[model samples]
Structure formats: structure tokens, C-alpha cells
Target: MKKKRKSLFWKFLDGVEKVGNRMPHPVTIFAILCVIVAVVSHITALTGTTVTYQGVDPKTFKAGEVTVKAVSLLNPEGIRYIFTSAVTNFTSFAPLGTVLVAMLGVGVAEETGLISTSLRKLVLSTPKTLITIVVVFAGVMSNIASDAGYVVLVPLGAIIFASVGRHPIAGLAAAFAGVSGGFSANLMIGTIDPLLAGISTEAAHLFRSDVSVTATSNLYFMIVSTFVITALGAFVTEKIVEPRLGEYKGSHTEIVEDITSDEKRGLKYALIAMILFIIGMVLLTAPANAILRDPKTGDILGHSPFMNSIVLIIALFFLVPGVAYGIGAETIKSDKDIVNGMSKAMSTMGSYLVLAFVASQFVAYFSYTKLGTIIAVKGADALEAAGLKGITLILMFVLLTAFINLFMGSASAKWAIMAPIFVPMFMQAGFAPEFTQVAYRIGDSTTNIISPLMNYFAVIVAFASKYDEDSGIGTLISTMVPYSIIFLIGWSILLIIWYFAGWPIGPGAQIFL
Candidate 1:
């Protein structure tokens, strides 16, 4: 018998894989993009390409119209910038400090095994009837531990499903969906909150010098999205993916063992530490005269000490509980263990550090050349001319980001490139940078499970292959596609409702300017 021809969708996925394989590393892409921007600056400056636009500054409300002319970065002054500003740009890149600092705390937690044990406990204790939902939700929560969900919950999901007489691959898909597909959604802030918020802040500087995107900017939206993705993942798994997967005849069954007594005591101690921390924060922020609240306005969320020290607060939140867990579990016999955890986390960021170096230079050049501003104004003008506004505009942007996500898998790297352009563009169209960031996140996250270029895709495929010897990229992506589609549609609808109803995306963040 002749082999059946591949479907167009499968062929397209294969083509995407080939193209992604041909693409260079993110660092090289950024470096080349930096060069291209410099050359473009030369060409535009020499050609007298200028854009005249004006708007009220979102922060100061100062309305001004000024002509912006592209500066040639290929000149002597530009070449000096290329060399002299390297360190400054690298150090000043907003996401660098935030991610690094936050990781110290997260590292300690992961190193002490707080995060991984918590995830396993949550998953293993879940009722079998609710296993799919719990597995997916646990995966979403595992974002705090970085890639631990991919390694722990996913395989464990297979084991849990197989033990419960369900299709293991389907279980794997549910977990993968919640981890990667729901990446940007969490009940509380994670490392991504600071990373993406910092990038958004940097981009907002072009339009409003004082407009800062905080880690909590998208908190409320993501809190709701946590449930949204949980339900969506569970639904897709039970209804679509599981049925498609049929019976698990592969005979590889494994039991998911419970967390150890030491781990349970660790969780209890961690919970106690977390409660104490919350109380302390409340004492500091709940009272009108509290230290963390605004002295003048008594605002805790806006332009307050609490808001300013958010990154530190986040780090402390993790550090305290992590140490508590470590002590209870005997994972930390000394300060050295804590230091080791932080070191491990930082070590993993080596690639990120390299990417940031090149990205910072690109951002610096783009800013110096005034290219980002020109592009934003021009793009905004074109958007206005085309009559795209509000939800329509946001949906189009979401689609654009989702498409770009297919090729550029690194969230921060992609945002570092897209933020300067889209954030300012959307700001001109009467949206907040936080709003733009959330929309970008929706697009970024919803397509992650289906993207061949996503950093963890290969690992997920490998996880799938263990259950079914024949499972490959196609098997995994196809399983995940349902989650991607539903999440993209569901999340976008939520955003649309938020837009029309004048809802707050977070404590001090709004959907519109």
C-alpha cells in the first residue's frame, strides 16, 4: 500500500521546522539586526527622511509637535557609540537587573527543592476525577520555577494518567499546554512579570519618559487568565486530544509516588513563612500611615514605596519561604546551599546575558538614530489612516505577535525587538504600554505550544516519545494545537471584554491611556 500524502497543515509545520532550523541563534539575529539598523540609519539620514508628529506626553501631558530626523549611526559619532556605549547599554537594559535579582530568590527556592516539591505535592494529591485540571493548573503555577514544569509535571502527568487508565500522551499534552501555552498567566507575579515589564518600561521611554511598566502591571488579567487557561487545557485534553489519542495500548504504566515526609514538612514551613510575609506586608501597606504606602496620597499601588520596591519585594517573598522550606527539609545546612542555588540560577542565564548584550546595543542604536520613534509615528499614522482602532487594532497586533512567535521563540528577546515599535505605536493610538504588553503576551503565550521554535518544544517531543515510541514533533504539535487555538480565542475575547468594560488590567494599570 502507498503511504498517505501529508496534509497541508503537516506540510506547513514541516516547512516551519526547516526554516526555523536554518535561522541562527537569537544572539546572532540581534547582532545582525543591530547592523541592519545602523545601515538603515545611514540611508535614511542621508535621504533626509524625517517624520513630523506631536502628541501629549502621557506622563506630563505636555503637547508638542516636533520634526524627527533620522541620525546616521554609520558616522564617526555613531561608531563611537557602537564602542563606548556597550557597557552602559548592557548595564542599563531594564530586564537585566530585574530578572537577575528575582532569580536569586527563585533560585534559592528551586535549589532548596521548594518549587519542585510543591508542584509534585499539588499534582499527586489532586483527585483523580480532577487530575487533568490539577495537572494543568500545577503546570501554570510551575512558571515560578522556570522550566521545572516541563521536566517534572509533564512526565509525571504521563505517569499519573497511565496509572489512572487514561491516555498518557493526552495527559502530557494537558501539562504542556498549561506550562507553555499559559506561560504568561499566573495567579501571582513570576520572573516573567519583571522581565517583560522592564522591557515595556524601556520602550515606553520613547513616548512618555516617566511612564513605567511595573511587574504588577498585568496582575489582575493574568490572575483571571490562570483559570481561563486551566479550564481550556482541561477541556481540550478531555474532549479533543484524549479522544483523538484513543486508548493507551503501549503498556508502559508508572505510579506517581507522593512527596516525602521531609517535603511535606518543608511545604508546611514554607506556607507558614509565606503567611508571615503577607502579614508583614499588610502591616506595612494596609494602614493609611504605613511605610509602604504613599506618604502624600496613601496609595499603595501607584507611585508608592511598595510599588517602587516591587522587585525587591518579589525577591524577598521567594527568599523567605525558600529558606524556610530549606530549613524544614534539611536542604540548607548552611548559607552555602542558598548561595549555590542563586549561583545555579545565574549560571543558567548565561545565554540570556549574551543575548541581552547584543539586544541592548541594538536598542541603544535604534534610540540614538531616532529610528524607533520614526517607525512608531509612521506606523501609528498608517494605522489611523487605515481606520483601525480599539479592539480591531489590538486583535491585529495579537495576530501579528502570534505569527512572529512562530519564528522567534524567546519571549524577552522578541519583546525587546517588538516593544519599541509596537508599544509606542499603540500608545499613539490611545493605549497604555501595559495594555500593549498584555496583548503581546496573549499572542506570545497562546502560540507557544504550537511553535516549533519554542526552546522547550524538542524536550516536550522527547517526553511524548517515551509514552509512544512513534510520537514525534507532529504528534506533539498536533496534540497541542487545540489548546493553542482555544487559548488564543478565549484570551483575546477576555481582553476585548476588558477593553469595552473599562476594566483595570492591574492595580494601577488600565487598558487605555
Candidate 2:
């Protein structure tokens, strides 16, 4: 009877999961919320009641106009405005361009068989315990290449783990955890560092006009967070996720493939090339007088040649080793082969391109409606009005971020909107921008693993299907929900502790007002 009852409970949960998974994506949900806000704003405009919190008021505070203007979808005026804005805000919205350009070099490297051979050799040599750590580590490191880790290492992690008789989902979870959850945390700064720093600087200026947050502001904290997330990910996989999965008596058999001699040679060449590249970078950046150092400040963190050219640095680092491996392994005899490799890498991004386009449109519309700002401002006002402070403020921010995360999956986009409101508001409440950013990150990351609107959510579901053909979005969500809840709780607690300690969130980044 107990066994039957347990089965019925799972069945019920499965039904609930299916219903939830089939709902509109977070962005679409946000669009719906946008409509609601528009209606409310219209009503407020008619009622002549002003909503004011703190001193700063929204542009819509007076709410005068409430008419549906016949806006042309292809208005020449709108087109001109967009073009002008794009040029003006080029750096502010340039991640896509930066990622694409970097990928050109990365494409050549990945195509030439360098990444594959190196990953295979590394996985083969490492012990089971060490393999988990290395996979997680590699996942973290892959952030340097942006989306490369998601397409390459995540599946490879599953393949490698399954080969060793471990549950493949556990490995996928570990890698995903490191890749997405550990996103803000890495040993080195990437494109995100600068992008987020710019946003932070802009937000901070609202409160302290003279203050500027550098790209490396969060570097120290991120470095520490990388390891903390890695350890937590491994533990969750081994203790929680894996045990729940039990032994893999599944139908799929592990394939045993040996590394070819040519591949081994290519691996050696790639390693040598990587070592040389690293040494060169160090030599160039190590001395204050080195050309890579900032001409004025002699620092690598601010306006440094090396920092400005980090994308090019990454391209060269990957390109050189990849070409060397391709030649050594006989994967690339001519230019055509290298081109083919890059093409193959790009082929995998088709889905992402579609997702990004839709997401970008939604983000653009949300910005146009001015709904995000209004909500953020109102939220900040409410928090301040409630007398929330310290850990209470941090937790409130986390929960608020998490809730917003459900309707807005893009971290950068969400932060772009939220930071302007929250950072200044929190600063007024005696919290620093760094502290607010950190709290927002915790909330943003914890929900990523479970949010259906996450672009990769579909991909993860497909990955899960490999284990169980019947697996759907429902199955994947059910499996990952535990991690989301646990991570939120655990990470929130850690933030509270970090808050009480009053430690610097990162280099030159403070925790308090």
C-alpha cells in the first residue's frame, strides 16, 4: 500500500510538472506583466493619484497620456532612432558583436580538433573523483569562450561520466552548475566583467557621482566564488542528485574509445602551444613597464592594453593551439578544413541565435514600455519603506531577484534594468553597489537551473531524453528543482554570513554604504 501510495504521489507530481513546463516562457510572462503595468499606468493616469516613494519619481509618475498611438512597425523615424541609439550605445550593447568576433578565432581552434583532442585526453587520464573536479573546472574556465562550454563541455561531461559507470545526468548537472551557476565566478575576467562593470558604474553614479566601479571590481570575490560553487556543485551531484538517480542500469551501454596516436601527438602540440601562449601573456603583463600595462596607471585592471584586448588575447590563445593541434593531428591539411571547423561550430549556434533574437525583441519592447524601470523603482521604494536592513535587505533582494528571474531570464538584461533602481535605492538604505550586485547574482543563478525560460532549458531537456526516451521538460524540471531550492537556501545563507562579516565583495568593491 505504501509503495502504491508513493507511486501515486509521483504520478501526481509528474502531472503538475507537465502543466507548469508547458506554460509560456519567462520572457512571454514578462510581456504579459508589461500589459498589466500598462493598464495600471493608464488607470493611474485617469485617477490623478500619484505614487511616490523616496524622493525619486518615475517619468510616468504624473501619468498624463493614455492613448494607443498608431505606431508603425517599420517607422522611418523609429529606424533612425534605433540606428542612432545603437551607435551611441555601441559599447553598452556590444556583447553579441564581441562574442561573434571572438568565436571566429575560436571556431578555427575548435574545428582544428584541438579542443576535442585535449578534452578527451584529459578526461581519459583523470581518475573518477578528479574527473568531476576537472569537468567542473573546465566548465568554469570555458566561460572565457562564452557559450562554448554549454555546447561542448556539457555534453562531453555526460559522455565522460557515463563511460565511468556514473549517472550521466549527475555529470551534466555538475557541468551546468559550474557553467551557469558559477558564471560570475571565475579565475579570470571575461567580457562579462567589463560589461557588468559598466552597468555598475552607471548605477553607482546615480548615488555617488564621482564613484566608478572597475572591470576587476568583483574579481577577488569571483575567484573565491568559483571554488565555493565548484565544491557545492560536486557535493550536490554526489550526495543528492546522484543518489536519487541510483545506479545506472539503463539501456545505454558505455562506449570505450581509445585515443589515436595522431590525436595524442596533436594533444601534445596543443599543450605546448598553450604553454607558450600563457608564458608570452605573463611576460608581457607581469612588469609594470610592459607594453600590455596601462600607459598611464601601469595597472592591468583599469584602461590596460591587456584588459582592453582580452578578447583578442583569448582568440590568439585558442587559435594558435587549435591550429597547431589541427596540423599535428592531420585534422586540417588546408585552409578549407579550418573553415569547415569554424562553420561546424557556428552550425551548433542556430538555436541560440533564434532564442537570442526573440529574447532581444522582448527586451527591447520591455525597455520601450518603461515597465521594467517602474517595477524596479516601486520595488526599491517598498523595500526602503519597510525599513529592511542588512541581511533582511539582502534576503529581500534575493527573493525579489528570484521572482523577477522567473519572468526575465536574461541576467544582464535584468541587471541593466534592476541595477539602475536597486543599486541607488540600496545605497540610500546603507548598502553598497557591490553588495547589491552580489545579492542579485545569487538570486539570478539559483533559479537558472530550474527556469523553463532559460534558453538552454530546452537543450537540457533533450539531454535528459538521452537517458530516458520519455523524458520531457517536465522530467528535467522535476530533477533540477531540488538543486534550485537547495542552492537558493544555501547561497542566501552564505550571502547573509558574508554580509555580517562586512568583507569586500571583490577587489576595490565594498560591502556597505
Candidate 1 residues 402-441, lDDT tens each?
8767756667756765676678878998999999999999
Model 2: lDDT of residue 241: 64
lDDT of 2 by residue, 268-353 (tens): 88889889999999999998699899888787754478767866776687788898889889888898887787687667555444
Best by lDDT: 1
The C-alpha lDDT values of all candidates are 0.78, 0.66
Q: Give the Cα error of residue 99 in candidate 2, in Å.
A: 7.0
Which residue ranges in model 1 land beyond 4 Å of their true spot? 1-5, 127-256, 387-513
Instruction: Give per-model TM-scores.
Output: 0.63, 0.70
Report the lDDT of model 1 for residue 15. 58
Worst 10 residues of 2 by lDDT: 56-65
